[model samples]
Target: MHYVNAKGILSNKNGMNLYRGCTHGCIYCDSRSNVYNMDHAFEDIEIKANATELLKKALKNKKEKVMIGTGSMTDPYIPLEKKIQSVRESLELINKYGHGFTCITKSNLVLRDLDLLKEINEKAKVVIQMTLTTYDEDLCKILEPNVCTTKERVKVLKILNKHDIPTVVWLCPILPFINDTEENINGILDYCIDSNVKGIICFGMGMTLREGNREYFYSKLDKQFPGLKEKYIKTYGNNYGIASPNQKELMKIFYKRTNENKIMNNPDEIFEYLHEFPSKDKTKQTTLF
Candidate 1:
């Protein structure tokens, strides 16, 4: 791990990445693509040394209160977070400024900030988003090796639900010929339903492959799924979106299950929910006045 002073923290859209690069060895990580242009190795995490301070400054200058998001390019709750505590400090700042908070992560370590999240939700809003790629515990280990497994993530969702904090799940990157199956989709959907997640974001039933990530993905496939690299090359040579042959079938199951469960399934709609700051506190104050 390494540290670097960041010029700025929040994006124009109110998102920030406290770290650059990730240790989670997910083979299909798009952040490794040449399009992102990282100067260091992917595992050598670059800490944004002044992220919390910059975030505080940004929040203070905002014209109106809005949700602040993180963990887009890298999970904020990565193992290294246990030491840096940047995410925790950022949450404290968001709560201090009365801004809503949301983040996308696969780590159960998010539970460490339950107190801050609850406090923020009571004041404004706090939504926890988790990514669930495969349902089978063994397959989940293979896909998202460095982070918490699917079952453990589901437990986090359930616990958040019990606390009345809404949650969303990213059901994506379903590797073609590996995890793109009816059983896999149904199993993950069952977990979402049981946990009462507010929504599920799925960009279809496939993962993307590009110059940098594609090469790394193929290398891992050769080692883990032997012969799969050749199949991918033969089928998707130079293509960006490596969609699954079962995309239509799996999507049918996804839409059917999420719709029946009353969970938001549309990507645009789910994003709106994540970005929208609730007015419950404001309404209560107005009512009292």
Candidate 2:
């Protein structure tokens, strides 16, 4: 882990990455892709030492409150976060200034901030976006080695639902031959349905493989799956979008199940929901006496 003095915190879209790179060790992490030009090792987390100060200033200066999002490029609740407390402090600042909060993570450590999330939701909104790629426990361990498994993530989602904090699921990076089967799709959707997630964001029934991540993913495949790397190379042949052969059938299941459950499956609509701030009057009314 390393620290750097950051010049800014939030993006123009009001999203922030408190850390650079990751430690979750997901085999298909897009952040590791060369397009991002990360200078450090993938697991060596880059902490924005001054992120909190920059965030406080940014939030204070904003004329209107907006949803503050994180964990787009890096999961905010990575293991190192347990000690750094950067995410916790960011939440405290967001709650202090009365801004909505949303984060994408695969860690159960999010439960530790339940109190703050609930507080912010009461005033504005707090959406927890979790990624669930594989439903099988053993496969989930192999695909997303370091983070909490799918069942634990589902449990976290259910807990968030019970607390009245809305949740969304990112059902993505579905490795073609590895986890793109109808069974895998159905299993993950079942978890979403049981959890009562507000939405499920899936970018089709496939994953991408660019320069950096493609190489890393192939290496892991060679070690874990054995002979799968040769198959991927032959099948994909340097293509970016690695679509599943079962994409059509699996997407049918994805749409049918999500529609029947009334969960939002449209990415644009879900993103709009995540970004939209609650009406100020509604927030003011909550505290009115």
Candidate 3:
């Protein structure tokens, strides 16, 4: 782990990444793509040493309260987070300023901040978004190694649901012939149903592979699935989005299940929901009546 001063903390959309690079080791991690231009090794972990300070200033001076988001570039709950507590500190700032908060992560460590999440949710809105790729435990390990398995994540989701904290699940990157099966989809969807998730975001039954990630994914595929790399080459070539052969069928299953469970299934709808902020206490009251 290392620290570097960042010019700014929040992005144009009010999103911030307290850390750069991730160690979760998701072979299909899109963040590993060269487009992001990460300077350090993927697992080296770069800390924005002043993220909390910058965030405090940004929130303190904001003309209006809005949803503060993070974990789009890297999971904010990585192991280093336990040692550094940057995410927690930033959350404190967001809560202190009466701003809504949301984060996308794949770790159960978010449980540690459940009280803060609940506080924000009560005063404003707090959404906990978790990515669920494979329902099978063993497959989850290979895909998202070094993080808590899907089962543990489900428990966290259920806990949030019990606290009335809205939860969204991202069921994505369904690799062809690996985890695109109906059983896998149903298994994960079942967890969503059981946990009473408010929404689910899935682009499609596919995964994107580019210069950096494609090589790593293919290399891992070669090591674990033998002959899978050749199959991917023959199937996808240099294309980016590799759709599952069962995309149509799997999508049908997804729509049917989500509709029956009353969970938001459209990616656009979920994204819009996450970005929208509640106007609670938006304008300062003149009197303390």
lDDT of each: 0.89, 0.91, 0.90
Model 1: lDDT of residue 125: 85
lDDT of 2 by residue, 138-204 (tens): 9999999999999999999999999999999999988978999988999999999999999999989
Candidate 3 lDDT by residue in tens digits, 233-259: 998899998899999999999999999
Candidate 3 ranges with C-alpha deviation above 4 Å: 281-289
Q: Give the clashing residue pairs of candidate 3, or none.
A: none
User: Which residue pairs clash within candidate 1?
Assistant: none
Q: Candidate 2: worst 10 consecutive residues by lDDT?
A: 280-289
Q: Give one clash count per candidate, in the order shown.
A: 0, 0, 0
Name the 10 consecutive residues with the lowest summed lDDT in model 3: 280-289
Report the Cα lDDT for candidate 2: 0.91
RMSD of each: 3.5, 3.5, 3.9
